[model samples]
Target: MRVHSLFLYPVKSLAGVEVSVIDLDDFGPVGDRRWMLVNDQGEFVTQRKLPALARIGTGIDERGVSVHIPGEGRFHLAPGHEELSVLVWRDWMNSLIGPKQASAAVSRFCERSLRFVYMPDDTFRRVDPARVVDQKRVGFADGFPFLFANQASLDELNSRLKHPVNMRHFRPNIVISGAEPWSEDHWQYLTIGQARFKAVKPCSRCVITTMDPDTGTKDPGTEPLRTLSTYRKTQDGVIFGQNAVHQDGDHLSVGDAVIICPQES
Candidate 1:
């Protein structure tokens, strides 16, 4: 199928930047989910706890990454370097032990126990499991580098919705056009060019999906998630999208053809 759009989130939970072309590494997009807001204890924070993160703006250029908040002056992160920094989400979680004292520190910024940290390119860190050799540096994603979605699936969901929704709501790294609606759900492995990705798990739906990336308004009271919940619900919860682990290193662009390999039963 054809790719309709490409997106990368330089900072986790903040708005994503649309790109004309993107380079794919082992995890996903090169710069996608590279930064995250953590608390003093190094715990992860997101819109679920603080919706205002939606207000943060981000831009990338030759100078590196730039972030803009309403009253706060713009902050820029330097490009990847040879040195490395070790930042952990678990560290931020431990800093929340002091009741309101700790909450106060974070509340000043947002409702969640979250702070911000940036990793230099030279930093060599392993994925959480500590076993998956993350030779390819990653930023702030839970794991994996890329998240791919099918345009046909979104179109089918929109057909069922009262109003048409744009691809922004789903926030995917890759969008394939030829596949059937939700066909990605059945994909066991996908090969795009020379890159290989294995569908490891079904991504659980969260409040973030309901919020409009453009207006930051909640609007998931419709089909797709609703329809998916009716049947796609796992024993745990309603699931959408597949989380993939990269098997090969390849560069992905706007029009790359994705080949889906069927699951052998």
Candidate 2:
């Protein structure tokens, strides 16, 4: 198989940026999910609650990150002086509140008070202890650093749905094209280019998948997830893709050769 595409979400729960290549650090992708939107209480906010966030454009460059709010304006995010405590799932983390102007601009767009928070190099959030025993870290992602999805699997899912959805709806970091439908369910280890990844857990589906990546509107019939749950439901939840942990290496690119192996019998 080959790497079909790569994507990075500079800010968690916002539209992602597609790239031809990605540099890696301890975090899965160099610019992936290092920034997040938080509420007045410092609780992480996401598209799950406010689907309109998907309309906000995010970009990353050599210097830093920026966000473009429709009609409001575009602002290059700058780390603010104040350090604040924030909540991401069950974990409480240290994050730098971004500049007041940027926060206020985004707040106007969302019609609520929201702050852009950055995960500085000094802060370290470990992988979920129940799933990974290693001391590896993640940025602002929900769990593991990488999410892998198969194109054939999406094709198969599309075939069963009245309206087909694209990979963006599911938000995978690595899109592999050559695998068969649902073949990733059996994938235990994979080598994409020089970096390796362990298929740590099957990613469970959520309502977010039912939202269009472009408009952030829910499918009228509640598709893909609805079809997937009919047959893909596991003990964990309605499942679709695999959550992976970066094993080693520092970079990967589109069209890189992908080699896979199932767990030994």
- Best candidate per TM-score, number? 2
What TM-score, computed on C-alpha atoms, does each candidate reach? 0.78, 0.97
lDDT of 1 by residue, 7-42 (tens): 888878888899878776644677776666666545
The sequence of per-residue lDDT tens digits that candidate 2 reaches over residues 65-127 is: 888888888889888778999999998999999888889988989899999999999899999
Alpha carbon lDDT at 228, candidate 1: 61
| Predicted structure with the largest lDDT when compared to the true one | 2
lDDT of 2 at 144: 86
Worst 10 residues of 2 by lDDT: 256-265
Clashing pairs in 2: none
Q: What is the lDDT for 31 in model 2? A: 81
Q: Give the distance in Å from residue 69's predicted Cα in candidate 2 to where it truly belongs.
A: 0.5
lDDT of each: 0.65, 0.91
lDDT of model 1, residue 227: 64
